[model samples]
Target: METRQEAVTGTIGCATAVLGAFAGIAVWFPYGRTALFGAFEGETNPTDLWLGLPVLALGGAATAVAVLTAVQGRRRIAVGLAAATAALAAFGYAFDVLAAPQALQDCGSPC
Candidate 1:
């Protein structure tokens, strides 16, 4: 039987690893660009406000559930679920096509 401490540690470790992957994807993925080219399409990246944030939120929820289960004495299952949660975040926008660096040109700043 696993102790509360051990289970919690495992869950956190897995969750943290997922979050690390999330950070890497965010830094490298294009957050701003034209989703489609057209005269009135304007410039906007729907992936940001739509896709990325939601998956992160879902992962957070899964992490929360994992912690909850860990405290209940189901460490192994909790760890697996927590890892799955984190993976869900990566599924969001992490694998999208990379756009030209100049398209958005540093979204938060002037390109």
Candidate 2:
């Protein structure tokens, strides 16, 4: 017998986690080589794809867990997933901001 507040909170947390995961994935994967070229005007590295795939998978799992917890009305679990999503999102952003530029730099012109 969960309270309405708990249910609402759980739903909100799940939504937050889902959105965060999507954002993290976007930053991690970008849009293949074309998108990378449009943004940074350089050759994209295969190594980046290797590194980002695992992060995207982990974020996807976190989002799924959040959704499941919300559906089950598990407020605490939903909240924990939401917090993990936030941390992952932050880490993804930091990795993109710091690592992306260096990788692009390595591409040189016409990358």
Candidate 3:
């Protein structure tokens, strides 16, 4: 049985996780697309460390806290958050490890 406080915490955690995941995806989308397709399109997409690095760091922190909260009291929400967080983490990883590098490479000497 979950107390009211626990329920509220879980709810907030779930919501935060969802929002964080959405935010992560939102931030990654443009860069990811540019990195993946810009070269072929004859356009150079440069990675913005200023914007991307902070968002990824913050989103990661938020997701970690949310997952901890959900695991403490809400099994159902935990599962959902786990999936969402996984996707967010994977997407972030791809953006950082693969996409960013590709984008940088595409930039040549001027980026």
Top candidate when judged by TM-score against the true structure: 2
Please report how far candidate 1 places residue 53 from its true position, in Å: 2.6
Candidate RMSDs in Å, in order, are 9.1, 7.0, 7.6
lDDT, candidate 3, 1-111, per-residue tens: 889997997687677656765766566666656654555535544554444545564565467665675667767766775676677567657656325444355566765
Q: After superposing candidate 1, which stretches have Cα over 4 Å from the reference?
A: 1-42, 96-111
Of 1 and 3, the candidate ahead on TM-score is: 1
- Clash totals, every prediction: 0, 2, 0
Comparing candidate 2 with candidate 3, which one achieves the higher lDDT?
A: 2
lDDT string, candidate 1, 1-111, tens digits = 999998987787667656755654464444433443311225545545455545555565567667667887999989898789768755753644334323555455542
TM-score of 3: 0.43
lDDT of each: 0.58, 0.63, 0.60
lDDT of 3 at 7: 91
Identify the runs in model 2 with alpha carbons over 4 angstroms from their true place.
1-30, 33-42, 97-111
Give every collision pair in model 2. 42-111, 43-111
